[model samples]
Target chain A: MAIAKICGTETEYGLRMLPPGDHNPVSISSLLVSSYVDEVQRQIDWDFEDESPGNDARGFSLESAMAPAVEAHLLNAVLANGSRYYVDHAHPELSTPECTDALELVRYDKAGEAILRRSMDAARRVLHEGASIVVYKNNSDGKGNSYGCHENYLMARSVPFAQIVHHVVPHFVSRQIFTGAGKIGSEARWWDRAEQAPHFQISQRADFFEEIVGLETTLKRPIVNTRDEPHADPQRYRRLHVIVGDANLSEVSTYLKVASTAIVLAMIEDGFFGEMDLTVENPVQAMHDVSADLELAKSFRLVSGRTVTALGIQWELLQLAKKYAAERGLDCVGGEERGSDALARWERTLELLEQDPSSLSRQLDWVAKLELLEAYRDRTGASWQDRRLAMLDLQYHDLRPERSLFARLDMERLTSDEDVDRAVREPPRGTRAWFRGTCLSRWPTQIVSANWDSLVFDVGSDPLRRVPMMDPLKGTADQVGALVAQAATPAELLRLLSE
Target chain B: MMPERELKKRSSASRQDEGDVAASAGAPPEAATAARQGERIKADLDDLLDEIDEVLEDNAEEFIRGYVQKGGE
Candidate 1:
């Protein structure tokens, strides 16, 4: 069912050149990404032969919706951890290796933060005097522009795309109550003259969305991205690349964001949600409105003309998820036990938000940020528009523990430091990442390039041998671990694979 | 809204970055207002440039070239 809910996260970290100046983000991003690849792991090229970002799921791409180019000359590398650390659109983007479960995704996501931290140090050694890369696990530049932290979930090809769009839009619109990373002031150009001018928003990425559905990511960003490029067996799976989430610093927030969404997707595929019409009239506007409403009392017009607050909608979804678990089971998200844990956590979080949003200061990003900002505002006697408050908001996302405002706060953590550290060097054993990471680690010199579904090896042959891994469920540690252990060289591995 | 007493009581215990608070606190009201005004202007310019970037990104061939030219590739 849904191929083990195979999921991954891609975060384009917000970066600034310290001793801030008019530095080219593209060059600095390239340097930062390359420093990690050059210093930390074996560098392998990303094969773009199968990439077709222009292919829209709706059978026709918008004429204006240009697909992201596969730039072969860029500083792209497949790490020994099976993750891709590369620069995309002048941002240092770290895409976690395919994960079999949500919790594993958290560990890998935390590992990505560590890798970025290490990248900063490595880049420091090479950067110009008095210049350094300060990375933030944030979505916005605080200048009306926002980056992305996209999540990928592998779903069965049998499920209709229209159903996915209909079910997910409400969750995407309402989930910000917990998933939000918090933002200072509204940057939405359209919301500039709204009746309720928000002093702060629940989510950093919510204000930047311009469409409910589309293929473009940088411009006219959609809540449910329509890019249908599945890096696996196309007939068997479709990777739902979600670009609507924030780059969360709170571990609990990250965990819940992935887990809850996975559970909802599972529920959708299992037909547990019977005629659930949670559609908002304008999803783009609703996302901003939900985030801006501090009281969590503002309601959006549903398709039925019924109004529901973000919290109310989430509560309904949670109840359905609970019933879904009771009936079919939650094996899609690790196991029934893990699924129950996600549900319990979701219920508790919603309860807290309902009772008092501030009660979740330690459990959620938006609450913690709100508490910190309010505290700062009271102490300094500053207004919400104060530049210091804005700076404080940005500092909350800083990656450095010594300087990070979020790190100082008593936020609840789900993953251990050891797990995060280990995840930086190793891949999750249950996915194809194990095969990809093992090859890169064992024979760094032999492997020429790698991607999600395959690897190309030189193996001393006149023609490079391309090993096809069309299935995400195959080539896992169980399937290839013994074979990998037995092979001594790339040539031997190639020969073994041929067999 | 937090009670004034509650805000004062908790803020001192919760506030760790004294230097940051002081930095923002040190700015004079007039200077801060002027700076905020400047930021608004700059934000307006940034919005315009981003719109231009969006237009460039809409075209397939031009977007690819721009991607490389902007050091994206």
Candidate 2:
């Protein structure tokens, strides 16, 4: 009944090159990305011809500088995996290819970490002695600033934006209980009524949110982002750009975050929540309040005039999800097995949240992080603001396998290293990414430039032939895997595709 | 020729880990004794702390103080 929920994630990693040589974040980020790109293949630049981040869903365009500035003097590389790895303003950002489901997203997301780790290794070899780069899959810099781990979901163009905001705001407010990569304390010191400041919060990005809906991501951040850049058929789809989440290191946390949100999107697309109101009285306050409630017992008043706990809100959503699955079958979040797994995990997570959240130390990032921090406190009796705790918080998200505290935890995993290695090189076969990636890997030297919906190939003389792949569902591995393998050159491949 | 690639289709069953997490998650909510689980968690935290001691940054306060960066969207 619902449209198949195609989704992806873009993570901007925190970059800090240790001591010695130059440690400007932007330069280090550029080095990390360009070094990795150059080591493997010819430089394949990202085409910014189609990106329209300025086109706000609220109607008129704000300013077109976000893309124009990135296009100039940026190390934007389109990966063989149909992902984009580049310097986003200052952070080294990696965006996964369009994934058909949440589970597929997990593998691709892990692959991104592998790529960044390799990038760090590559940068180290080229840098001066004692000058090394470090990357953290985290949101904030422990200062007043915060970056984003944004999720993009495809919604039917016909679905009104207001309806999306109305239905999704409450989930965004409450889902932080599990989606959060926990932090030490509030970043908004101005908003801190010091007596009431939470020592620790469930979400790293919660204090940063100040609006209910907005186009601004870095400032006056919104609970529901309104960026309307559909990198597909605009007449048929809407890309819901979500920038409120934390950069998670836990596989289960990432999985549940994407999967549950996908399920909710499916319900929204199918018009399943008929007249049911799940609105928070004030979403920005509710988002921060939910994050601050460590006891998980704070209640917020809803538009329906009933007050409910964040856990209560999640349970209500979960019940509706189960009913939607039973009635509609979860084809929207990718077939029965993956959908069922999402539903089951969602249920188990909520039940654990209510009965024993500490038990989820192995499943959720915030819980695992809290457990690690608390364990450190028990060992040394350090307060929340202790420098050791802050370092521990940042180290938990470090990208290095050996250095990453997340890697050491016995966390529940939805993907394997073997699978992640494959994902690092290959794209998921269900979408056009299969064709896009297959072409790039096979014709690496010949490809001149690439982007989300098209690939321009250099065929030695004739104008660069651009193969447009606007339909996200077409050009699957099932559809083009053999064709890609059989072709000897980009010229033949283009000819065959035309034929 | 294109490199030899494995499908590596991740199965739903792979979501289950070989840790106590999957076991406790699969167990009925009421059936898992919360108090005993709490004790086990306290015990596990002890084990985790031992591992953490080895991996923690040597100059933690200095490292954290110097870890600032330019944030982005």
Candidate 3:
């Protein structure tokens, strides 16, 4: 059987202070995060001692790929909602709490957006007159630089890194058919040819990735990232940090992005993909080409000399996942039911794409964005390179609910408004997040620092007691809710834990 | 301490599926049985809430009030 697919997302929102001139993003992002933390009154610090971003899974460490420094000066706060709301690399980042299933993850991701929206409001009060900060849930800045909306999945440590790379590379290259968040035009050097003009691409992050496999995220990003930080029992599991995905506004796209990837990971762990190597020759180039090809007909040669389109590859993966589920059951992708939902949606999306890509204009992010832009261009007689169109593209991702084009779209929502509202305040009950969130909610001031796998409590003692949550599946509501309710203060909780 | 609120509305979305997995691919019989066992394990291992609002009522009033308050005229 496959391991439980525990997962979460870390979204680094693009930020710019209004009257966008020579301004520092670091200061603006810090202001945004600080204002939110101040407004919520949950200003607990983040523990960064367990992070090991430089330890690559490819056996040898890249000495140049130094881990991110823990800047204690930055406004890094752990929310009572079991999330980390902070400034990461000069961008306002919201790392959702660990979730047991994809649907729960979607609710938390939406809550992150709500947090950003509130942060925008809080930041406005502190800003200078006629100057407000704006945040976008998109990947690129329309310049050469790109931010990330990274995904993390827990995989078993027994699986070889090489097999993970080989199996996942093809899916990463081709899954953009539905997972893409859509971009205005290409910025990669390879697309600078005279014959191939810069036009709308399917994915916003594809053009920026330069390497097939690497450790550096800001510079040369890899398709299958080799970062081996599990944040759990290291001997039992490995956390797959995927940096290649775009921040999707459409809920259906977000669901598919996490669910389908989880199913594939399960198949990989179960040894179900027997000799089915759909490895592309040059994944970096193919990733760009597949994104640029809107028609979904552009074919890339696989390692077996067989040419396959992105849609074709998705269809193959879907069929395999279906068979895997039929035999193994959809248990690893949450349960039989949720796994079935993923397959049904995956099949329907592929079926619609096969008929006409426009058929999915309401469900898929790229198609809807393309339709919106093209309709505007036709109505106003504007060229593809019109600056107004680019502005429209940027407005699609604006964090302000009323101004955001994505918010206005008739996209299928997997989560309810009430649930999303609750997720903004409460944590999921099935993981260690329950303990972390309940603690923060019960005794906010007593907690000094918290991270993915540990929490430090100040009990009016000289040395704070650190509770280790090394098991992602442990410390759930069933295990810790009674204990948390029974203990009142940090001292009592520590005593109870010791008992 | 506040009483645990009963969820009047279904907080967790109904994970209803349209169709079953099409077992067209040629997998051995053992694989199918292994998958069934996996399904049993999945159910036993994780205890998720059918009603998310039960545990989620702690800060609802504060959150909604804050949201409306922040939407200043």
Candidate 4:
């Protein structure tokens, strides 16, 4: 049986510094994060000592591959919500903590958005009247360059990486049918001819993929990223770093995106995908084709000599997932109850795509945005090449509540406002984040820094005390809530942890 | 906050139906609509476009042209 698929997401929002003094993204990105970190809680630096980005799953280390560093101007604050609000390259990135289930992932991810929104307000108060920062919960800035909304899932280190690469690519290529954040026209589009170019695409990240599988994320990007940083015991675990998805504005899109992928991963870990081969002949080409295919009828040849539409491929995967659920209970990827509900929603989503994709505008981001673009075109009789639709595309992802086109659409919500509000301040109670957050809130003055697997504490001794969290499932509010409450001090907590 | 838009869209939809009695395709046919939220968004599509047009930023094309970003992971 597969171990529990504890998962999370790291979203790097597209941002820009409006003109006045400096438009450099790095500086503005740092400012945006610092303002947020400054207001909510005392700064807790992210401990970078554990990061091993160079350690690859492909059996070789690119020692030259270095993780981004924290400079004086850049900020890397570990929030009390167990999220990392920091500057990643040029964008403000938020990494949610380990979530035991998909629903918890949604709430925490939304909390990241709310955090970014609040950061915008905080920055505006400090910036010159005309100079300000604008943030988009999106992937592209219309340039050839793109950022990422990466997903990380914990799986067995023994599960062969080759099997994961082969089985997961087809799903990643096709899942964009529902997971896309919607983009107007193609950036650095493959086809140059007017006839071959797409007016709009379902995915914002599809046009940027150039490889099927690799470790490189920014340059020569790959669909199935092989980043091997487990942030856990390496001998027992492997963290699957997925960089193919778009930064979603719709809560439904984000929910489905993470849930469906986590379920697929759980199946792979259990070897439930025995003898099932859904590999596309060319996954890179298939991803682009699926994204450009507005009619959802484009079919591509599979490695097995059968051609299947993206929707058809999803249906086959769903059928297998249902079988897996019956054979072995869905105790891994979110418990059986939530897992069953997620599968049902996945089935209904595919059915709607088959019958009439337009009917799902209220639940899918790409469809919702597509409908708005169509309405705009019908009213003004504009082409897909029109720039106004592009602005509309950008505005839909705006973080500001008043300006965000997505907020006005009344899209379906799986998490409540109260839950999102609480998620912003509090961590999910089911995971190790509860312990991390509770410690930070209780003894912010003594804690030095935090990482996924350890927390450093300054207990006023010559040496600092560090608490190691190796198991993502351990240190839950259930496990350590009372232990933390009774300690009353960092030194006492360290003593309890040692015991 | 949201009820205002819903009420306005519904009232205008009814008014358009009453006024479009002479025209065949001017108003969205009531009998042909689905009760899905999406179908309702389509039914009041005109009002949606109007609201969007009213709130859209000035000089949007230039703003989009200026929105360029660097590569990241």
Candidate 5:
């Protein structure tokens, strides 16, 4: 039996206050996250030291022994649990420890819920707390935007990186159907030929701009990850860092989202699914395509020259899942109605693929994608030119307000040099602190500050922190290929300054 | 060929095992005395078992004869 380990944490939602007399419900919810963080932190000082032997005073402890005083201090606070409330970038994020099983994962995810409820209660206790909070479970706003929904998987480094991505991407794309937090509206369809909607059945972003960088807000991208670090153990393991998923309100959906992926990954490692043949024609487009689809019928050709549609792969995996369920004596899949619906959808998608692969193929085109976007908008009765939509479009795309038309037209064309220079010289709107912030920002600041040369963060460190920035204009055909060349670990790269 | 007396003894021992199980199951509760008085079921069961065993022993020669006939057929 393959052991499954799923460890994930979500930030306490950030709040953005609406102007006086604005009746938008979402804005009210946003205000709650903003005001709640300060009140919660005032009640508990997460930076308090624990006095345990051989333990750093500032470091966190699994058990509250080192700082008995701090433990006693926490009881006086609103949150009875010793969970810390800290500033994650600009957002208040409550992180739960890595859990070993699905039930434990549920417990950790629920911890966020408890934190939110308590914060709301605390707010009610205080006078002049007028703001409401809306928690978003999305990665980006619709219209090619991006946000963070980070995933951290402890993987054995012995597995090759290429193999991990190959087996994982298709499932990552398809999993959104079950796990997608529903979205409200869409953008104007760019193409006039097709009647497809611009808005999606599942929108990654409900709100446009998020000041924070964490998973608790929204599901914008199918996966937002930085493939920078790899563990050095000879019996290698890679902690897969994933940041793209909606903050799930439904416990069952959250369980299925995390557990099913863990199982699929286990199957991949176990060679139960055989091998994923989809060599994504364009990795970035494939990612965006997966995010846009609602029915999960999108098909990509396998490396074997055969096409295994997402529906096909899911059906085969479900068969194996049935055996797993039986062996584990789990009734998780017991609901006949849901099982029937899943089966029906699975069959319907298979039929669609067999009847018309062109329907899916057309979706691959930029024009068709725009049509889908428009179709969704029409269905939702949303205007494409709405300012909220525009801001959402920019935010979801992670496009800077000042980005040139050329950069907007081709993100792959933007090189490390241009990105670095822009980040250093002009920096995007509200991003001046990316250079100084202790918390990680949405953009890779460590690489950007290094410029194209070997970046060095500190001079005295034994290993110098360096990153190779690829010249986007002159680099290879791969979009990220032109960015930065891989350098020594941050520690090694930092040591070069002293030399 | 004459069967060993030990086989007969083993059969009798298995019968005693069944009797032990039935005895250890305990008598009906006082609440069911009315139903138990009318049933007299254990006596009937014991009589049926004796009849069954007698029937088997009496038909043993004929049973062997039928087996040989079936083989011939």
Candidate 6:
């Protein structure tokens, strides 16, 4: 056994205010937090100190220069469980400390529910006072936009980055069925039919993202961040930095989403899952394909050079999930009945793909192409020089809500620097985080300001470990070489070198 | 027994005499005065009864409305 340990935390909530009327809803959240803080503190104190086998309560609080009146009024108190629930930016985020076991981690995560329930009760208490809080677990609103629900994982630097990517990428793309916090609008729209539900689905597209692989603290981040920040034993551990998921509401979904990836990575390391044939007709096209329709399946080559459908791999994983659930006496994986539905869908998809792979490929291609064309029209203008060429733009860069200089100009007119400057100042809400500084030159808010509080964990560990996964599509040969070079051992490097 | 009969006859005779005196006084007939007194008493009683009935009706309506609205029914 690799002695697996898993812990991560994030908050995904929507911003809402009372409509201008006699009722004021924004203040309600604050009032609610204040009223329930004492009760919540009492509950946490009982759970943490009173229930502990030993009365050892130290090394949790840190002194700060915050005004005492403000702190007391805000209920800025630390709990005995080594978890602090204090206001973060503007959101209430409950961050769990790295736990020794998965069960412990889940228990700590559940504490967030208790905290939220208390807060809601407090809100109801002062409902007459007038303030309402809106919670959103989505990354972006319906109209091709984005927000943040970050992920943090602890891993060992001893594990080769290449191996991690191979184990993690497929699961990352496929995990959306369980982990996706449903969406209301289409992700991609057709150019001619701009009004159609633009790629609207109820889940995060596992594929439509940028790949910037490095630890450099710049304005732009790699889609899969590998920056190592050791919070524990640095010599032995690495923390994987993930920043491309919509916050999920369902606890089971969140657990399955992260835990399944961790399990797959472990299996890959233990040689349980064989090497996958990772070749794609177009790596960018495939990513766009995956992003456009999560249900779309692709054929991946196995190490044996035999082509296997993505749906086939999912079926195999579903069987493993069934076995895991049975052994653990779990009613279902992630406490969800729908996990079985997902398994069934994969089985059905595999059978269909087995009958005819080409038809599936063509269908996926059509979807991918249509999404690309619509994304381009939305980004550029309606009168694109070559509608077919839009695929290049969609793959070359992520489609943000911002417009380029050429995009604003009439197809016939030339543009000036002033025109570009004005457009850049106030880019659309969905501009890519990477391009905000470079193109828009606007410093976007890095620290999210939420009304909810967060818990801080000092695990007393060394630097966090990070392993970068390769973009199955769009990653350059040099980038792949760099990742291969970072492998800890010769054997791992040799595998990639041979390839 | 003879004394009791005499007292009753005297009381009846006095009532008749009082009625004759009020009728002869010409303000109003004694029977009309009695009917007015009876009507006044009846109006007062009806007002009290109506007040009680309104209170009960209002309370019952409120209780039923509250029960159904709260999903109690």
Most TM-score-accurate candidate? 4
Predicted candidate 1 versus true structure: per-residue lDDT over A21-99, tens digit per residue = 5678888889999888888776788888887777788877565544445356768999888899888877888999999
lDDT of 4 by residue, A1-499 (tens): 8888899999998886776234888888988988877877799877877888877888888866764453434688888888888888888899998898888899999999999999998898888787778888989887788999999999999999998998899999999999998888777656867578687899999989999888798888999888888888888999999999988878888888988998899899888888999989999999999999999999999989999999999999999999999999889977889999899999999998998898888889999999988999988998887777887889989887766888767688999999999998888787888888888888888889898888999999969887888888889999888889889789898788779
Q: Interface root mean square deviation for model 2, in Å?
A: 1.7
Candidate 6 residue lDDT tens string, A1-499: 3324344555433333332233222243345445565544332211111111111111122233222343233334233333335443344444543333233334445444345545655655655566444332335433344445556565655776666555555555444444454432354433346454333342443323544333321223234545444343445655565655545433334545555554454454444454343433333333334444544454645455565455555556656655543444222122334334434444443454455422222122222223334444555464433422332322211111021111211111122334323322222111111111111121112111111111111122343212222111112233343643464443343345457
Q: What is the DockQ of candidate 1?
A: 0.06
Q: Any runs in candidate 1 off by more than 4 Å, and if so which?
A: A61-70, A192-195, B1-73
Candidate 6 chain A: worst-modelled 10 consecutive residues by lDDT? A45-54
Docking level for model 1: incorrect
Report lDDT (Cα) of residue A447, candidate 5.
29
Worst 10 residues of 2 chain B by lDDT: B1-10
Compute each candidate's TM-score over C-alphas: 0.86, 0.92, 0.86, 0.93, 0.44, 0.45
Give a tens-digit lDDT track for model 4, residues B1-73: 3754665567566646744652554545544443433445776555667677555656788787788888877
Q: Output the worst ten-in-a-row residue range by lDDT, candidate 1 chain A.
A: A61-70
Colliding pairs, model 2: none
Which has the greatest DockQ? 4
Candidate 2 C-alpha lDDT tens digits along B17-57: 32356476576565455555565556556655655656677
In terms of docking quality, model 3 is incorrect
Candidate 3 at A363: error in angstroms?
A: 0.9
Give the lowest summed-lDDT range of ten residues in model 5 chain A.
A430-439
**Candidate 3: which stretches are off by over 4 Å?**
A67-70, A192-195, B1-73
Judged by TM-score relative to the true structure, which candidate is superior, 2 or 3?
2
TM-score (C-alpha) between model 4 and the true structure: 0.93
Work out the iRMS of candidate 4.
Answer: 1.8
